[model samples]
Target: MNMLNVSSNAFMIAFFLYCGAFIVHAIAVMGRKFSNREPEAHVKKWGRFGLILTLIGLGSQLVYFFTRWAGSGHIPVSNMYEFMTFLSMMVIVAFAILYMIYKTSLLGLFALPITIILMAYAAVFPQEVQPLVPSLKSIWLNIHVTLAALGESFFAVGFAAGLMYLLRTVKFDSSAKVDKRQQKWLEFTLVVIIIVIGFIGTVFAFRASGYEAVFVQQQVTDVDTGGTNDSKIEKVIYHMPPLVAPHNSDTESYTSFLGMKEPLFEAPSWMNGVNAGRKLNTVLWSVISGLLLYGVLRLIIRKPLSRALSPYLADIDPDDLDEISYRAIAIGFPIFTLGALIFAMIWAEIAWGRFWGWDPKEVWALITWLYYSAYLHLRLSKGWQGRNSAWLAVLGFLIVMFTLVGVNLIIAGLHSYAGTE
Candidate 1:
């Protein structure tokens, strides 16, 4: 009967549909390799099916979104959990629109997986709806964030297309003189992806094993009573373990290895957000686990991760991929500017009594905008198209990620409204 329960169920169902779509799209692409006769027709059938499944999934998610909005009595984009979910949902919608224009089944292979990963990542976070703090009670919360997510979702599609372009265009044949720097950058991208997967896997493992602990400093007020408790509540350190726990966190529950905590140095005081320790821990674990994964793969294959992934995308059209990459950003940049910068400033003025503060989030937003501005300027005006433009598009999206995720995780500021919940 509760809204949360109903919305959660719908979200799960939508995720499965997305998973089904991924499988079908994958089959469509793979079928192209096998069915020489009527290959286009064969792939089209499967692609259509995949699109239908994706549309169904999107619809189900929309139902979940509205149901949550009805149940929660607000747009469900407040916390990291809800914001990530909403972003994935927007990614789905954006991908759907792009698929209509490009009609490429291969696009699904990249785009759908991104959404799936985002959905899985979002699911891992605490999903409880929190009462809005004073700043977030305004109508602008939805307008500002929802628009920004929509803009970024389009940029995400550009990232996917840019990635696909790099895979198709970049040489990995070993016979051709490969640029070591290109290989290194590609490997770096793979490591970034591995880090995300690593975080998800480690968190899932901890939760499955019921490995929960208490961080005495986790600032949380009771839901019913705005009263603080004398003793700290039990919280799971899901960011994989803190590389350096605060001196005060050496509790009985804080497990250690060989009578010492890993990276014995204490976390810097500046990292003092509510879940600062956990977020830092998550980053460390992500990097360490990602390196381990990259090392293991390198040992097995004796090649860079990018080279390993290149063959899959080798057959894709370089021009189409490049066009999609360019088009996505061209369409997205204006929307992103209007929403992330303009609407954000308007909301900030209303909420914080200023249009702009040098908040980390605000700074990063400006950086993202400037980076993309240069990207567009180079591509359109300076004739910096092809691999150079693709590279810029790819790098620009990284800036977007830093603005979106890094801001929330590393630096706490007025935009820390998400953490207030």
Candidate 2:
């Protein structure tokens, strides 16, 4: 069979393995619910099984990526499908690390489904092999793309942990009889919401402000050897090749179809000079709007912010959540800095002929890196811990998500190969 077919088949096998693991985890959880005691052995067995399956799935995914790289003669993250695969793999690796550290079987239950969803999403996008254009043929391709994926994956795990922290802190009245079934259900619901909101926010933000193109227009005037300008002049428009669609097609049409019908649309006037300003604006608005909505909903539910916080106040030692958040960030921050910033710059220099061109992807990656670095610095220097750290962790993940998925989807730049068609 061809490489593509091989990759597809491997992915299918991995998908099944993940699905089986998911079911086993569910069964383990159910066993715990029925017994009103931890199904320690069963949970442990299932967790190990799930981890093994995930490892196998991870191997299969690597094979798929390698085959695709061989087939295309470049990195696999040149489109949406590849990025999803990359994202899934990164998350799985991150989950494995966390599992090793915390020894929490519950994380497997949460993380496996997310990995499956991402892999499934990848399946829906196109998987055809296309030749790498002139721009993508750089050694930096691997470093920049891989590091960015790794950083995002770390953030994804942090988000999952944050959700878990939130769920573990839920209050259901120990004074009044709490229904075991209902409590479990509520816990599950809360975990799902935290994960979903974190994921969605990051995804949306990344989509809005991640990849961008900057145009530099040069006015070329014919000059004599003496350096006196002649009347003849030409306007030469130069810019980095767009990483994705509208810009790619537009550039092609502008250069190739000069006098013919303009087949591509100009960027909206509001978006003309600002590069990725519109997308950045969209992300800002989204964050603000989401926070506002959450506030309003909280207000409606409890009639007062103080009362709404009372349950959390009573059940959660914000200090513990803050410590967990700090620890996760401390662990993830260096990995992110190394992968997203240092390695990416090295790759950029090799691939794009510049180590730091402020390409949208580069810019966003730096922003993410700086945000986390700041988080670490704040925690260490300013004694910013607990609730403050947790909030920053949440925000840091948001920034990381934007750098990973958002830049590829929303912004336009050299990373176009990482987008959906």
Q: Please list the residue runs of candidate 1 whose C-alpha ends up more than 4 Å from where it truly belongs after superposition.
A: 174-178, 215-239, 255-265, 268-275, 296-302, 419-421
Compose the digit string of candidate 1's lDDT tens values, residues 88-129: 999998898889898988888888988998898887777877
Best model number under lDDT: 1
- How accurate locally is residue 275 in candidate 1, as Cα lDDT from 0 to 100? 65
Candidate-wise lDDT, in order: 0.80, 0.60
- Name the 10 consecutive residues with the lowest summed lDDT in model 1: 231-240
lDDT by residue (288-351, candidate 2, tens digit) is 5456655566667854332343343333344444554566566767777777778777766666
User: What pairs collide in candidate 1?
Assistant: none
The lDDT, on a scale of 0 to 1, for candidate 2 is 0.60
Q: Which runs in model 2 stand beyond 4 Å of their true positions? A: 26-31, 36-38, 170-328, 382-386
Model 2 TM-score on a 0 to 1 scale? 0.63
Q: Which RMSD does model 2 reach against the true structure?
A: 10.4
- Report the lDDT of model 1 for residue 359: 93
Query: Which of the numbered candidates is closest to the native, going by highest TM-score?
Result: 1
